[model samples]
Target: MSESYEKFEGLIPGDGHPRWGQSYYYNAYDPVRCLGVFIRLGFLENQGEANSWVIVFRNGSPLFTRTNLNLPHTLARPADGVEIAGMRIHAEVPLKRTRITFSSPDCSFDLVWSELHPLADCIAMTQDKDGAFAREVAHIHLEGTSTVTGSITHRGEMAALDGKGFRDIAAGPRNWDALLHYRLAWPVFDNGMAFCGIRGISTAGGSAYMRMMHDGEAWRRVTAIEDRLTFSPDGLAVEHAHWVFTDELGRRHEMTARPLFGWLFPFDTFVLREHMMEYRLADGTIGYGLHETGYRLPWQGMAD
Candidate 1:
């Protein structure tokens, strides 16, 4: 029932929804250059700001990590593109492709993402409150695929971006702290697939809304979900997780994940932890993606 909402590629979460948020995000790894990029632009309507961050990783470790506490929400141009405070993400080919440019005193990058696979859908699982909040959170993950190219410059050294990447545009009214858990994984598998849902790893109550995309189509829109997550005592990572999703067709599929690395973002209200992981399927193929856990975790000593 979640996916009945139509899919669109242009700027979304327009002028309504007072609590709305829209995120334009991308992640890619360049094996030859041993560089990786993960950037996110969070447009929050209520706050009238775009809280964005950029993490540039080199040789498996972070080279640069920076965040913009608040960029004006006016930067979210859903039609042609967005340009805000030295960062610009404009369309190169409309629905199927885009070019992103980011410049700052420390480093800069210009990249293009060209679509290779079609779009997929996934719902964000939250409480069944029978209200607009549930409707807003339930609509998440308009996913896509692309090959990235261009250049990344840091500390006088430069590297070309010739990598495969996954992208998603998430839009909705969000009371982020109220969300306890959701898992977004896109293990870099040759199978050309991705999955997002909620199953294990929640102390507070929440429901399930799992969905999977395979080879540019809806592989499964889940009707039932089961998951188990084991987090480290420090709450910095989800060390292991297993999920079984039952599709609307009543067939079940399983997937397992283990972490490669993770980061924790502490806020005044909650802690957000996300890990990059390697996942294995029943067929023995492996892929890489993120395991993100939201809301408060058992972390003891981080400042807001």
Candidate 2:
């Protein structure tokens, strides 16, 4: 399955839209060490530059962060991998295996991702009168769960990481300011169940994209999602969240999220608050992954 679309598309000719871009995001968490890392590498060929955002967390606080929005980049995908700002994401075997590496004055890492499941395509079902899919979220988006193992050296202290992780790649025209608000969750359970869902509101309308992979089963599209969330006093972070996803087979799967720690990344249009959450299923199964929300700026809290 990966043989078809795993290769990077690089920058394709667009309709001269400034938002034409391609990006890849990779995340890993070491449950034993309570450490996690998030990396987003993006290229805006129309603008002739790229962006690299890397954040490392320990015990719920940011240990290291690097955000470079203005950096030289290549117009096409390099044979080795997508290298920018001293970071690289190379596909060792398309979707089956990948190698990620980075180096800096204070921190460096070499991690390998081995997929536990095949890549799942996020096909949006909601469309507006103008026929926009997921409010034109992305032309192509794919996500999956994996087993990550590597070593990270920070401040001369090396830590061996072995745990679960998640990754996604997206490409096409994307306007960061198009959405008024959004909520997303991707939890990979220890029992082999994984879910990836999102609900976003835009001027066009509300859009939903959901997919889940059951243990030893193929990915299934979720028909509907009932999302509920609780926020901190500042409304900038999530206290907890509950969600009921209805799969195509008419089965309801419920899950609860309790955030362990969170970090914020602010953009001109919105502030992305991301948390490494501890998740619990109705059946008492526990897991870990990312729970993220996007709110438009000026610091207004979550809508009532």
Candidate 3:
């Protein structure tokens, strides 16, 4: 059952958690067009509240940015797709492909995302410490490729965008501050290589994992908990991301990623700092991806 993807994986259950519901997230960057975007929608099951955040960037500068909490929202599945406010997200091919659209009086997007590789299966996030709560949010990681062909309007400036980007859908509780800290990154290069890495600390414990897909075969599965990434002085505001890791085949992979432009967002649950970076490898291969840092718990203040 876990082999093939499921359409409902992208949709919400009829009734959700009472305290905090789930969220749907997706982000992408197409370097050629100098375009980048981030979107998140969260539903609070018990409270009947919905929260959302969105940002669109051109040449590393924000073109549109907005964050709203407990907004009066009506989420419904017209047929099988999910709709909130004026946004519509429908899975066109079960787990394989999806169409996401947002059209409000102020902002809009028309984009399609196709799963280019299988997501990591759900796993235990920690062996000790806050293992149970940690597993609640860090269960699975879904990675995909996106083609964004839309114009986002903000402050009366509209920009046309086209780019290749990364996205994810994780099934878990929506308690953002409950998490300690973690980072997830996947880069789909022009030369046809898709790579992903994730790791973080839970109150009880922590975990790290990595995977790569190339030449049309499933990702090699093994314990990949040895990746290391270092940042510059300004951290999220800077372009430096030095990465080194050993793959499943005992091969060393290393690269330095630099951002063309940077973006910052202090969301309701947590704060995110991002660098839409292009990477340089040992073999002189240059590729595009993102460098990001997230702060959970104390890093964010209580929602006012």
RMSD of each: 4.6, 2.4, 4.8
- By lDDT, the better pick of 1 and 3 is 1
lDDT of candidate 2 over 1-304, digit per residue (tens): 5465755534445557677777777788888999889888777778887887988888888878998878885764532577777788788777778898999999999998888877766643222213333335566677888899998889999988888888877767777687767888989887888888877766455554444544548777677788899999888789999988887778888999999878888766677888889999899998899999988766565455
lDDT of each: 0.64, 0.77, 0.59
The candidate that achieves the highest lDDT relative to the unseen native structure: 2
Ranking of all predicted structures according to lDDT, beginning with the best and ending with the worst:
2, 1, 3
Candidate 1 lDDT score relative to the true structure: 0.64
lDDT at 164, model 2: 85
**Superposition TM-score, candidate 2 onto the true structure:** 0.92
Measured with C-alpha atoms, the lDDT of residue 79 in candidate 2 is 28
Error of 3 at 275 (Å): 2.9
Angstrom error of the Cα, residue 177, model 1: value is 2.5
Give per-model TM-scores: 0.80, 0.92, 0.77
Q: Can you rank all candidates by TM-score, best first?
A: 2, 1, 3
Judging by lDDT, tell me the better candidate of 1 and 2: 2
Tell me the tens digit of each residue's lDDT in model 3 across 172-194: 45555655666655566666655
- Per-residue lDDT value at 264 in model 1: 66
